[model samples]
Target: MSSPPAVPVTLAEIARLAGVGRAAVSNWRRRHSTFPPRIGGTDVSPHFSLADVEEWLRSNKKLGKATSREWLWPRFEALGDRNETGLAIAVVGRLLAAGEGDDGGPDDVGSGAVRAAVELGQREGPSDILTFLLRRWLDTYVRQITTTPEPLADLMADLALWVRESIEGEPREDVVTVLDPACGVGHLLAAAATAVPAALNRPAALLGCDRDPVLTALSDVRLALLPRPGTLPPMPVIASGDSLRADPLIGTQADMVLCNPPSNERDWGYEDLATDARWVHGMPPRTEPELAWVQHCLARLRPGGSAVLLLPPTVAARKAGRRIRGSLLRTGALRAVVALPPGAAAPHSVSLHLWVLRRSVAGETPSGPEELLLVDAAARFPRSETRENGPEWSELGAFIRSVVGASGGRAAGGARNGATAEDADTTAWATVVPVIDLLDDEVDLTPGRHIMSAPGHAGPRLTDSWNEVRELLDGLQTERARLAALDLTSGAADQPNATVGELLRAGALSLRSGRHPTEAVAPEPQHARIPLLTLSDLLLDGSPSGWTNPDDAVVAEPGDVVVVGIAREFSAWVHEGPPMAVGPQVHVLRADPQVLDHWFLAGSLKAPANARHAGTHASSSSRIDVRRLQVRRLSLPEQQHYSEVFRHLAAFERLVERLGIVARKLGQDLGDELAAGRLAHGK
Candidate 1:
């Protein structure tokens, strides 16, 4: 037989490969008798042979547009279930690595799973094929099986590579080795492999160890997939065993260590390894499992090498871990404590800390002048965060850079004076707290407390606030007069009214929603980038609130009526700004300029009748039924008049909002000045 066409696929997979919907695939099966029949699987989700589906798609003119990963995932799904899938993939990788070259095929592996996989190896080297397979595995199965979020792996890798350079200094010829003792699926290890070449212009030897055998096998395959430069320190080594108890790579020391070890495990070999050599900092209390992992990471690093460990916030000030924290700081091993936002990692509700550590180089002491960097990045997450999505990647990248830059100054022996709240804008958000201050009774390492005792607005004068309030009041009075002058009553004119669905059907307006073809990951703010208009931006300010790739989002044209689809209060705006993309919670209604005025449609949509029909909910996050909204149809002349009046009223409302902000700030400043006795009893 011809290898049984190894890759098995489902109807849904067929649709994805063909870049169409499942219904279309069903239609094809019913209408075209030539379509492939189900080979396996339940009645609800029937499976088909991958090769047959592709052939069918080709014969029917539909098989040439999918990404390589999309084409490979179904093949892996056909191999076996999730548990044995990784092993089956490992076997195929081993076969290709051994130079079998797809010769043995199903005869060599004794299964249908290896047939297409061997062909894949023949086409795109075994390493590349394995990388694609591993990524699919991680995206689909890793989160449900592991606690570490995928993004955190990238962050830890970046921090580790950055610290390695800081510790080793520049212009090196030797290959650097990076290790991850608790490497889960080798995320940090993969990151390190990529970062070493991109940052330091050198090859890297990646070392990883995990107690779980399956993870070890998975990590080994992933490490083999990493791209290699010119010859480095031996091939990437991943060992399976408890890294803390009997380290498989004990004699070897890595130049940098990066890890996200499991925490809160009670039986993490504490009884058998009480006096292990790794606990040179202090004997970790039995309750603090994270400290044990911390010591293991520190012990694996060579002298002057840096290690960045992601730990729970409790490790910084826990009663049991306090002694180790103080010891690490006193010896200058602990360089910085960065408090990340809650959603930065998995277990998404807990805000974790990144502890930047350096093994004690000979003759280095952090007695008095060596201040530890403490960064308050707890508020670093984007304000537009939802319960489902965590922090933004670009923002997290910026935070990591800021933390590294702040600590880099200290590591290079560059000391500077303390910055008050007045000079905060000129300096980074991090503060350098002396080691002596941290060696207090509690040994607290929370970033918010040690960094800057005062809030950002500590020094602005009441006079300045009052002047702004005065200016805003003047503008508001003028706008109020303008609002009063407009003819305010609805005209007694006969007109037909229609729902938004009717207008859509009549071709008077086109409603467009869903992602654009060229959409990409959004860029971070604080950089010069195109603004993406979110629902919050629509409801609060008339401007954009976030950044996105111009291609990844749909742009709002000048005449388009934008509606907020998820909010306690409904809002609609006519886009008058430069081209901006619509965010997730927004819908764009492009009106025919010849038939309707954009401003008039928006005003009518905002009215009580239309707003009530749009959708009402106790939770603002509930989506609005924008298509069900009603609009009043009027003569073009009447619409133009109403549009003109609505434009003036909107401008007036904006001025009033500005006036409110100024009034609130003036009240706050007045209270602060009075409390400080700066204007006691009006002098």
Candidate 2:
């Protein structure tokens, strides 16, 4: 093989091979307890064999395989294996980091209010920023451990415990290996490794993979750092390369594979690799790479090996994709499908789905057209307010745990027998609806269909919610009517003014955009400091939010307002007193103090009329900021009104913010009660 890697690899060497930043290598060690041992028992500069660590990464390279099998079919896709060492180079060179923009901030439009938040966080006690960062980072570590959807950290940790329970219940005789193909930075791998001892009293066979060199390397560092019981392997297997195109660890069969593949890709690089091997079921449509990933994962596993994947609804019932669907059902590889909440995947707006696949038996056994085990998990999750960091993921994990533990409830419609003697004999509580109802046109996989969407509270029913919604709508309509009666067109509030649309067409005010910065972490300049507002720094409601850990390097000026054209989408909001500079992509509109009021500019940018001019948003790691934004115009008088409106809107938004905070408290408390069974009927 590769010449018995010298001694053990050094973390620095590993970091280089993995393509990560040096700091990231250290962070990986600090985060993962089971990282390779230090050469001299020194945590700092600890070293391990490159070959040994590479194997460890390969062992966990299950994720890469799943990703490969899904898109390329039979053919193996090779993603550039990477970690953080050379990440800076790749991000700068290949990714074209500037071509794409970030998704815009939170959807809510509380601009002035958000500005206040960023200012407050910046001005607040140092502890707030430090505490935020530490907690967030720790949560990220916990999330990596579970390798699950973006579940809340605590909930994901618990769900990981449940995964162990499910696997343990299956009666494993030896060490168990779990693979996550799209292991973004090794969340599931870390969890699988950690859970092995707790759930099955054995060491974990946690492994993972990804197409991005950055992610794979990051995964390596994360897996390397975990503390292991002396008996366990020192590192987790994490490799870089397209999991679908080529196998990182050829001739390896894993017991369990888990993943959340990218929803859809335009050029998954499939056109170049036709006539490949992985596609035993059928060729996947370019539009439906997810299907290929599903089949590829099935091909990778040994018989009786199980896998879980997050999917979109189309995989279940789309007519264009019926061939693979029919094949999977007839082959009986499909185990179960769980419907998740609509907004389950935050970064991606698509409705999320979960699918479980098991390899079919060789002989024509009792298993025939098996009905997939379907769990409508949409309504089971705790409300968003209660989700600690991310509630959607928290509830999803808990529900997954419950379903996995549930006994054989239903069989696919084509099964030879109604229920196998072994299955019928199980005592675990579960229900199995026939597959016929879930088939064909009836097969929409939204969780709302299968999962019971019952509210935990005993007091109110659906009718109450309906009434409240109506009441709220009625109140809003009344308020609108009242405002319409104000005769604003003739009043001082309403003047002969041009909309922001007109100003842009005429070019009275100036809209300038700064160049995109080459480096994300650059040395602080000793010039007049300006608040650099990336889309990320601003929350959806137009609040200037900071990372849990604050980066004091970027500051703001007095009238600096940020309009983000990142992955999140576009909207402009003024920063509070602290002056901030706009990121390179975000267009900075400089107005003479007399010409354009800062608040008015922010209001005009947010005005619904100007949204169309913002241009179509694209789907990429970075967002798109169109040049059109830099050419907008607005009259001085109209700008003044826009500014005034922002002032009033800001106050109302703050009130809503308080109400939300209170609501979140109630939701969290309610979740605790419900999950603990305190909210059960008659309790």
Candidate 3:
């Protein structure tokens, strides 16, 4: 019936359908005579007909007991193309929003995909279905699509709304309008839509524009499905086409704007739009596409309206954009420049910036001394095990609020005089530098530059430093004395050795690799509970910086040896506390106390010979083939003796490491205080 649905399924998808792994699917194709043949796709990733796979699965009783919603995704994903799939998803959203008995629904409601979507929508709510589908789609095309993370989107929305509230006072009856010119999948707009009504207690008219038609359609559907409080707001206006060239929403102005536009785009209509009117500051050079977006967002704002743009860090200090940066500062449009830590959003390795701007009302002069807030909140992020988890928003948000509040006070009145060195020290992370101070030849708007530590009074700080130094020196001497007592001697002894693979086969130890978190299932720092030990922690001998859900965790119990699977320097740690999750690129080796000593195994894994032999590459940076690593074959008594020596050596190494860290910190502090004339030599 219905021509077998003609949808293609990859081996991975087939494995998912059968509730098995890719290897199982491969085995089936090899061993089973009735297994489906490849209809299309490459040899590396062959595609099979979904109908054929389903028939074979049902005949063999291998089909997973999955709901209709689960089945809908693979079929939906197999649509004509990416754009078509996006459009189909959008159509499904529209159909879901239409509800039952709505004759106004799309005419193609009888289509299999549409029918399945309708059934799923009825079983679950329309909002949940759309959210589920969109999340999966985004996850599937993570590298291809550039959507803002929800937390970062929420932060941008909150920042814009808070700034608006601060400037305009109490909530007004007028409906606030918010615009995002490069809305992408409309995360920012959706965030703003939710935040504006809640904060302002009034309706919000949302506007969005993106170059992709499918994205525009999807955005419209997404905004429509959002649950609003009290009275319903007007339907959002999502326009298609490049906002820079075609100017879809040209004449529109909004109370607030939030955007995370594409960065470093070269052909963003520079030549054709040279004399365009949006360049209130100055014409942006071809290389400064982010600056163009900055001006565009500013232009879209109503007088005194606020905007927040997530931009690349280079936009703050690039030489080409210096003129525009200065103009924005001089005109008092640029309110603040906050530098977010790396992993805040896409391009996770580089620290991105949030440039907060406000449109100046006609004929408004500078109130008190004009100043711009510069906040470098990089250090404020919660201690994360990996860079991918991003910052803890609550702490970061509070820090920004405090900085902004302090800056507001400084703006009304001139900079405070007779401020103590302690007060100056506190402002090192956040400073409200005068606009005049920033209008130099470079006109660099980098937050780090303006927020550098200022010379402070050394009275109390110098006293504290002396106390710290004395304590560190005493501890260093104690560690050195302990090290001297060891009287260590090194010698090589030939012995029979067995590879880790042999040990595993002999049931001497159990080896398990850490599970890598998927984008959808990855634990956020806020939601995580169990401590997660990462490769960085293993290498540096530091405490756990990551966290994860206990159910998905690969926990290492006490006496288990955790080894870094990939590193320039091979290292291993003996777990000493409660069970903890091991993050990606880490291996947990649980040794049987009767067969092998945990300390001995850990120490053996860190040997230079093992590092070279197990490494896959000739260079220092290489992945370790843990199975290939050889361990000495020794009696249990001999192993215990070696373990004791290894344990003491490890403790001695840790002490030396601490001594080095403390000594360096004390040296830097003393050097800084003395050089700044805050401290004098004691007689």
Candidate 4:
């Protein structure tokens, strides 16, 4: 009756099984490598038995199994071509990974690997840029751009993703449509689509319109290109054109409006729309880029619709622009102004704010006086980054979704990702300051400035990371002090340049590397833990390398000389911090106080002629390469030169420290106020 499963699958099925493109399968035979060999497909298509390959791949993944098309494919060719087909991606993963070891890089399942797997899809086809874009899109799909909206664009996207996802929390009527008038490439629309999956029973009927034809065209295509085929239809007609000037989607009343319009597009057709109906709250001043988008988004939405847009910080407190901004806030339609990080955008890195707006008739609204929900994610995510990443998006999204309370449903909803209020103890750090707090400070809505660094994380526990950061900070502080003391003791010019051997003889340099097996240091995709340094650590004085950097491990302490190219500036004081790691680029130099004071050496690098001469030999760029340091004119008494130049270096170091402290204090004060929620009190 039933019988065994059919034997050889089609070439297409083979390709699918391998997770490789059809051509990749063809290449396997051409390469004549050890891939499983089953035969069957259009034009003598070859295949392998499923049982044979799956076992082999599992074994390979466990070991350092690097494979090549040459190494693994022929195995398939040897076996009788054959079978297995289903709607699952797992079937193909095994065959695809079967011959993947020879590349040498890890076959680890990750974004990089994902990119590599997709790279094969174009083995026998496609252009580079398209491939580039494809890989980037795949990366983007795996990630949520960010939840923390710092720049005007960031805030806008955040509000958009938030509202789109919020629909499922409350089972609203499936008919409500959401629109983003000034959409740039449909980022918001796509995010909305994902957040409100059709399975939720209430799909977000996502729509958007942008003035830029190019951006709009791309959005149309992107909406169509779902990761998996045949799931949902491409998004409905997303209009292209200036929404303010032309009514492209005329007579359409959207249930929700999300827009992050251009902040400063000089010519906005302002003169033509003086009597625009959307300007119910306030008209746009020549300077305010947010005003036009604000009115346009509002006009597009029906009564009770919600519109969230990001505005410049200047709008909140700028005296001249205050009338419009103030009036809107007073109107209560301005639900929130969440401040963001300064470097959140390109061209300019300035703090921005998000303004959440609700559409309601003058008299009919919720119970409380107009209130605002301010979130300062600026401090919650990666501090050094201009824009937040995936984890940040997930975290920030949770805040907005939970805070809004999913009114079409209930308040206190669950966190977006795996996070909970208890995950990092974040709820304790969450500050719900009032609009008046912002107004009191004249609305200086800088998230970093307002949100204070709390004692601990919110919900999840991060004890290990917290402790590590504390240790790092302590090290920096200790190093700073040692450098300061040396500045006063050795002055700047006490150090003179010298080679690693000289520093070693004088107890300033030491060489450390694996002695027995140099081969043990074979390059991993990521470099060794040893840090690479540059001369940027020292200014004026010839800088040493391998002193301090994130990746650097301090194997050699302060006094140990990192021998690089040459020895010079031996007399310069240890102006740089202590116990720093040296890069191969720079040899760490440990100095003997009895032989030469570091202060005196600090000034010796200033001799322009010597500086240039040393740099030429050392291969230093804008910053010096300590490894390049070589023994130049050692004829001069090094200590004498070091002593001469010490004072100037010390003065510079002290001044920098003072300036840093002041800047930090100002930032900390603002963060403190925002975190306490004192700034977020009633409007």
Name the candidate that leads on lDDT.
Answer: 3
Off by over 4 Å in 3: 3-85, 100-114, 168-173, 366-369, 382-388, 409-428, 452-492, 500-568, 572-599, 612-628, 644-676, 680-683
lDDT: which is higher, 1 or 3?
3
lDDT of 4 by residue, 178-275 (tens): 68776655666655555445323345666778776645654554554433223443345678888878968867787667666676775787788788
**Cα lDDT of all candidates, in order?**
0.70, 0.50, 0.77, 0.47
Once model 4 is optimally superposed onto the true structure by TM-score, how far is the C-alpha of residue 445 displaced, in angstroms? 6.1
Q: How many steric clashes between backbone atoms does each model show?
A: 1, 109, 2, 117
Which scores greater on lDDT, model 1 or model 4? 1
RMSD of 1: 8.2
**Against the true structure, whose TM-score is highest?**
3
Query: RMSD to the native, candidate 4?
Result: 15.1
lDDT, residue 285, model 4: 74
Q: Which ranges of candidate 1 are over 4 A from the true structure? A: 1-8, 39-44, 67-69, 102-110, 145-158, 161-173, 197-202, 366-369, 382-390, 410-428, 453-683
Off by over 4 Å in 4: 1-171, 198-200, 227-234, 342-348, 361-363, 366-368, 379-683
Worst 10 residues of 3 by lDDT: 412-421
Q: Model 2: runs farther than 4 Å from truth?
A: 1-171, 182-184, 209-218, 234-242, 262-280, 342-346, 361-370, 376-392, 403-433, 441-683
Scored by Cα lDDT, where does model 4 land?
Answer: 0.47
